[model samples]
Target: MELSAGKFLCLFALLSVVSAEIFFEDRFDDEWEKRWVKSDWKKDGDGAGDWNHTAGKWFGDENDKGIQTYPDYRFFAISAQFPEFSNKDKSLVFQFSVKHEQKLDCGGGYMKLLSGDVDQKKFGAETPYSIMFGPDICGYSTKKVHAILTRNGKNHLIKKEVPCETDQLTHLYTFIIRPDATYSILIDNVEKQSGSLYNDWDLLPPKTIKDPDAKKPEDWDEKEYIPDPDDKKPEGYDDIPKEIPDTDTKKPEDWDDEEDGEWTPPTIPNPEYKGAWKQKKIKNPNYKGKWKAPMIDNPDFSDDPDLYVFPNLKYVGIELWQVKSGTLFDNVLITDDAEYAKKVAEETWGKHKDAEKAAFDEAEKKKEEEEKANEKNDIDDIDDDDDDADDTDAEDSHEKDDDNNKIEEEATSTHDEL
Candidate 1:
């Protein structure tokens, strides 16, 4: 009962797809309100901003909608729960697409993966998370992806500078952590950073450290160069003055020696004078290399086989404070397969990225045209004001001429009468 090669390959593909488990996914469709819960942590203080369900002001597809943060200078907190799962000996992947349509000046576009059931109504910056991954933008100083992982009640941030997309366009961010403790960060399906969790985070003590007992020997000559004793100072070096009187100077014709001080020529810098003298340097014959304590195995370091595991992950959330909100989050996914996540990104962000960019460019061009039109209108207004001022000046001149003619007529009548 042997199967054909084509049939075997198809069966294999089906089995592969089945093995990749998706713990949670959200396209933020019409039923998104049912799936998501908004926090009321700042509602009473009038600091909580609302979330708008739309594709944004400029988007490729109206149907391809997501949840967006609304208004400026407010806090936003929202969460969605899924069945509990663990990534003890498996790969864990978190991915989503975000678009900072407001050209986010200072805000976070990152998402969080919660380990347990969290109070969705009070979910804010204080809520603990197992992993936080995505872009965090704040002017020119901070424009990098934040990859933070929580272990043993402590959250550890990745020690790598991973740059993110700063444009006002949709970008897919993917974070994958493997059982082997290696992690990778992808922006728009392209790998931007990858390293071991042990190296990137302070999850565990370092494997090696400098030997504590090792110290520099007392007689060790660590200096590479020494002053040359054979190099001597030139004769009459100190006698050469730093300044010399200018020989071209002549006495002034109107010099008052009694009233003013005696005339002295101004001094100029001496070209022949060397400011200071010092001995030259030469390589030391007994020079030893720079001293460093030898490295040895750290006694406190103990490797954990499950450093990358995040057990009981049951929720995904977004908690942020945006000074200018317009960050749209969509296509959130948590899975055990990298390929499946990549495929999802491709079908969503990849398919519409170019169209979105084109739409954004068109909007920017329209805005520029409007600004130029406003500038032209302002100039026209200024010119109109100047023309009115000139007209008033002409009227005033006419009034003055009439007054002068009346005075002249009065004066001529008086002279004729006299």
Candidate 2:
């Protein structure tokens, strides 16, 4: 039986489709309320734990509805439980969109992947998560992605610093964990960081390390250069002053000799000054190479090729502590196909991210224009006050002139009668 080329190609495509799984997705539609469980955790002293759930695009973009945390210094959590699945020998993608409507001054714009008997009601910052992936910002600095993957009961944070978007617009953050123990972080469908999980995270302690017994050999001259023993400092090296009085300065003519004290000229950097002299350096002839401790097998390290596997993945949640709120999370997806995540990002976040940015820029421009207009109005008010003051002065002068003319007429009339 001969199989045609067309048949073979079709078989390949079908198998590829079968290998990947779309485990979970939420567009946060109107019915999204039923899907997510908002935690009842309270802030300090019984403050309200708020989560602002929206039923449409944020700021009027075409993306779906999203949930936003509210109130300054509050604890928020929302979770969705799903059928358990494993990500062994297959790709895993955890993707979502975040918009810091308040521009995120010290807050988290990330989500957590929780599993193993998660009580949605009890979920909070204390609840354990399998993966926590997204951006975190604080103060003036500290704007980076926080990718924490839990393995063997310990959460290992990615050592490589992956920068995150700080703008007020919606951004898509996707974390891809491949079957080959490699991971990639994507911001807006573009790869920001990619490397082996083994190298980037301390998922497992180092496989090998410097031997504890090794030590540097005696008399190993590691210095690259040393001061020349024969070289001497040039004569008069100490005589040069670091700074000198400015010879071009002349005393002001208004200075009084007796009343005013003598004035001194401002000091200037001395042109004849040379830096403190020292013996010149010479290459060390006895220099040896840098010392390195011999490596030996680490007894504690045991490599597990399936270090990236998660057997009982059940839920994906957004559990975070936001100092300043107004962080929107939506378009959450958990799948085994990398391309599917990218497509969803494009159709949703990728589609509306630019429009969100334009809206933000437009708002900023409008604010600046209003400020300028207000300043101009203030200046105009000041000018109007000045004009009023001048008119009052002119009125007073006219009144005085009339009074003087009346006095002179009265005196002239008296003289004519006499």
Candidate 3:
């Protein structure tokens, strides 16, 4: 048998495809060996639980079945390392099952692929490319699975509402990350939705820090935005017509550096005290500064002319002028005994007259606009009737033309027979 070059190449390609297996699973159910790293993700708390050898369980917080009991209402993440991914391999699949003793209120306990190694001390950095569980209280999240894939390393928020069931003993969640960087999630082996993560929500910045006014430090500005070098599309949007570069966009410079500075070592109020401040209750009486409280004007005070106080004493001088009783008092009244009332009335009358005229003018303008709107409506009604007549005539002409064409066809057939 003679083997051609084409046949040999096809065989080689087939062998390469068959040799690709990137998954590692711990199927032995061994309780002693730490195959996966476990951690209590309760923000700031220690992982607490006892492993039940007989029941093969880990218990903590509240749901303390024989196998699993956690003291804090936090999720214990277990992960295996896979440092073998290259740019060539695109699709990755993850499968897992979870059983809850009772329904939970807190939105916790979901599995994801972390880019970095995660353990008790720190949560590894991984774009939440997949979510297979839900917080029990967020209604109707039974086997709710959400799958996300990284094209340029941004998460596209997609909400998949699964049918709620609290009594289900165990639920299986599966995800298929495709070659094109799009992903699909399946709950109980049923795929509800699939989308391309290369465009749209998948490539957006984190929702919490997307706003320009958000609290972000100048030094750590790079952490806030994940720049995408490859993808820049305007899919799943109406306002945007084309892709735009987000490279030039940066955190505002005006952000306070002092406030945003990382926690620094504090200087002791008195370093001479060789111990904790509380242990040495040394009262330094020299610290005599009391915190000042701002003073507010008395609200009970009234701006009334009747409340004014007057003394029957001779004035130093007389700058003679007559003014109205309600006229505004001048500061010069202390030195001069002038009739300031007359000057105030003359000055204030013009302002009062103008205010009255302005009110009347505004009312007149509003009335005129209303009348104009009514007139316009009447004109629009007449125009609408004319438009209807024109439309009817155009329709009649079209129908007549169609009828004439049919009659001509009949006459032509009869002539041909003769």
Candidate 4:
């Protein structure tokens, strides 16, 4: 059955929107506590693994909802499983925000995308994942945005080194893998790096390789220089010594041959000395360019334009170790629409970043004032204790005078009766 031209066009557009729709999203609201499972798998064997809610110091709204990681020897491996989906020919968009309020030292702030079946409760470093993307900071040496893809049981790391934000502020990380095997990494919606998967990762054997049967000709000359037969070594070159006694030298006056050891002059570099003589080198007339291997189609290589595709994606996880916590993760989204992901970031982080910064500043200022006030009060308390001790001494001196007055009053009453 054939449809009318107008109806066929409408059908195509409708399917496009459906396919590009947001397949998975978690704003990490209050209800997210139930949806996300905190894995008992801790790497350090010291735990209390958990995720805290914050309005985000960057946003300053606890109700907006983001999970905060705690500090000090924690290995948090938590996962949230969703309905299975695949990249297909559509673009895959993954976006999320991370904030390190505690000024993290060395830790991992990455998230993972898993395929097929997964045990959410038991997810750990050993568990398989399809993709792992985010910033990882371990000292100054390793501050990079990791974009790793799992292909054929091996993890393919991004060839290009991408820098990440290390300040105690919020930053958005976006990874977009297109159907054409090209990918882009974005920081706060700005593209930082973009390239092809085949070039950036060793996903498959090279498309072309050096032909094993091809070899350089026997007469091929790679040398840039050749020995000059006309040039000869100078006569008596070996007669000159590399070092000789100073000609103006004289023994110290303190030296005595019988009772003391004789003094010898220090050797100086000989002026007549020349380096070991050799024939001079002239440019090689038969010099050819450096030999290059001839490239041929690799027999084991096959083209897969959609190497970035991952069929049956079922879960997303945040499994990492932290030395200092206070990392907030929020606004997770997976979709085929790049514009949609950008809009979400603008609405959430872009809109409130400045205000949140101001709020953080205000809080810090207030804390400083309170500490000063407490210090002043501590000094005042000591002064008050000293004043109380002086008052007690004055009361003790008055006690004897009061007892003598009472006896004098009783004696005066008996004199009036006499």
Candidate 5:
């Protein structure tokens, strides 16, 4: 059991690396139900949507399954707890993969990280969270990654618009926040957005603001252009009427002044008339440029050294209202290493993406063919109905003719008898 100093240090370093890389991870294996708790928040009313553990209708691997929203127009709430940890002086990376199998017309595909203990059964939208990140899609207007951070009991949304993947295929979304107050948003392992927390969120007042006491001088010539003093209105400019009687119009042949209400000619816009004129603008020599209040350091602004810290993060939850369901969430990872997250994304989403696309395309093709076949069947049914109606009409016509013949025969026989 004796070991050299170098060997012991190496083993300790390896253990630290492994521990630091992964804080919480879930591939959503068969034992997911043991770890996850489905909330009964909306179960009594309107019914809470259920989650299906499957790889979906089309996927690269059948066994690579995830939890999917099963029904449309229902609220879903679920949470899973992990050993509590904090990102006090470390880089925090939160990532997951989502596939909007229903095309996600309007719904939230985001996940929340909650601090402290949670009432899993009651976990819903009202439950507080330390950080919320992922894609949120709604029609054509809203398709962006949400990166919200909670500070002082208030949630602050990222000010920058970071667009996300809206495709039906699976996509990897990664959000990374560092101890230095910088953050990044990645979609499919590509950096979509990166900036400082102070600049991106309104957690603190602005560092600089327009000087409240400063004002533009009363005689400051801010206007860049002024009316030409030499310009004057023409003598006949006001004389041209906007409308005049059309000379091409003629009086009707049957026109009677008393009967036809004087037979006035229709009016037309005058060709010679022009809109109201203004003196041409010329550059002003005394222009002092656009005046602005000088900026000064904001007195209300106070930077926090621990802006990126989220202490006691414990649970990860999914709580949202979906208009149309079929969003699959899997490969959830919370770590301190960005590279490890990327590797996880590449192994799951990247490795299987192409095969998944191929499967999706095949499914689409099959669906299209089925739709066309159904349309054809409907058309044939309509044709068959028309043919049946025609046959019935022909039979009715023949019966009517036989009745006419019988009546004519009876009349002839009576006449002959008479």
Candidate 6:
């Protein structure tokens, strides 16, 4: 059948659009495809294993038709192995889809991009990481969408949870991990959380252990070569004489600064001393009068290891009230920059005596208040005990009355019967 002119153009445009669509398999070489190793969770149950590969048409599996069944409540782990990847790549992006049969436990089965021995013999008893997604199904509603990305050996986790309907087919979870050590998680193609540990200087390198069998070269065949004693002697013995260098240069006799005139040293300066004087000794005043550079000796001042210097303030006073009504000095006083020894001496001598007196008065008032609070608490406790005792007495009296009534009734009945 021949199409109309407009129909032909429409068909042509549709084909052009389809041609632009990218096929994932076309981008990577066939060798790259071999890197992936598929794991079947169903294999653990039915020896004849399969996977639900219908959802991933971009990447084909070893199974024909690319269709498989999913287990009732099981998880499958697929790992991408690149033996050379150890030296080639440090960071990678692993994205996949997950649909649970039901909200199981707070211990929702964990999915992790683990890099360790995939072989059972070399597989470690404990994996280096099993980064968790949530506490349990209770952590979110039954139909919830969650995505998490763990980086820097899975120590750091970036998670995002959204309302999702479990029955609503399949959805994608994507993670992008960078070499700079920043990781991000995306659920359903929408960006979620992003974090980094690149700034931490003492970070551990992400590692994936190989199977013990993989320690040696793949081509190592014992039958190919025979061990001969002569062949096993040493590597360089064949050309040892030719490998040695001739000793022709003479050794230097002594070190000489002038030999290398390109460098120079600077002159040094001599030390100088100044005059020193004998330190003067100070004394304390006998009474709390004007503060004087302490007198040579005074008995009225306590002999206890205290040395105080009282400096007097001299002024021509106009009124008695201006001098603070006869200058009442109580506590000790000392300069702010006084040395430890000087401060001890001043404190022992009761420096700022007036200040100390005021402090003592305030402390006395606080003590009285505390004593009153304690007495009130004690009285409240006593009242509580008295009320308890009164209730007990009342209960005992009621019991006694009950017994007396029963006894009277019994005595009356016996008399009637007789």
TM-score of each model, in listed order? 0.90, 0.75, 0.35, 0.77, 0.86, 0.28
Cα TM-score of candidate 6: 0.28
Tell me model 1's lDDT, rounded to 2 decimals: 0.92
**Residue pairs of candidate 5 with colliding backbone atoms:** none
lDDT of each: 0.92, 0.85, 0.38, 0.86, 0.92, 0.35
Question: What root-mean-square deviation over C-alphas does model 6 reach?
Answer: 43.7
RMSD of 5: 4.7
Candidates ranked by TM-score, best first?
A: 1, 5, 4, 2, 3, 6
Instruction: State the lDDT of candidate 3 residue by residue for 1-418, as single tens digits.
Output: 9779999978776665455443333221444235444333433544332223221111111211112334433334334444423323334455443344333433333445443323423333331332222213334443343343333345444544444233313333444545555655554446655664443233433323223334433333223233343444434434433444344455567656688764333332342223321221334433434433334443443332211111121111101111111011011111110112122222332223344345446656887999999999999999999999899989998999999989999999999999
Q: Candidate 2: global Cα-lDDT? A: 0.85
- Give candidate 3's TM-score: 0.35
lDDT of 4 by residue, 266-303 (tens): 89999898878878999999999799889999999998
Angstrom error of the Cα, residue 178, model 4: value is 1.3
For this target, which candidate reaches the highest TM-score against the unseen true structure? 1
- Regions more than 4 Å wrong, model 2: 1-19, 43-48, 55-63, 226-281, 361-418
Model 4 scores a C-alpha lDDT of: 0.86
Q: lDDT by residue for model 2 over 1-418, one digit each (tens)?
A: 9879999988776676566588999988778879898777564475545766673233546445788777777777779988999899899899988888887888788888887898887778888889999999998789999999998788888999999999877788999999999989999899999999999999988989999998898988899999998998878889999999998998899988688887888999998998888788999999887988999999999989899998889988877777787888889999999876876787887777666667777878998999999999999999999999889888988988888889989999999999
lDDT for 378 in candidate 2 is 97
The candidate, 2 or 6, that scores higher on lDDT is 2
- RMSD (CA, angstroms), candidate 3: 44.9
Q: Please, what are the lDDT tens digits per residue for candidate 1 over residues 1-418?
A: 9999999988887787788999999999999999999999799979999999999988888899999998899999999999999998899999999999998999999999998878889998899899999999998899999999888889898999999999899999999999988989999899999999988899998999999999899988998999998999989998999999998988898999988879999999999988998889999998988999999999999988988888799999999899999999999999999988987888899988888889889999999999999999999999999999999999999999999999999999999999
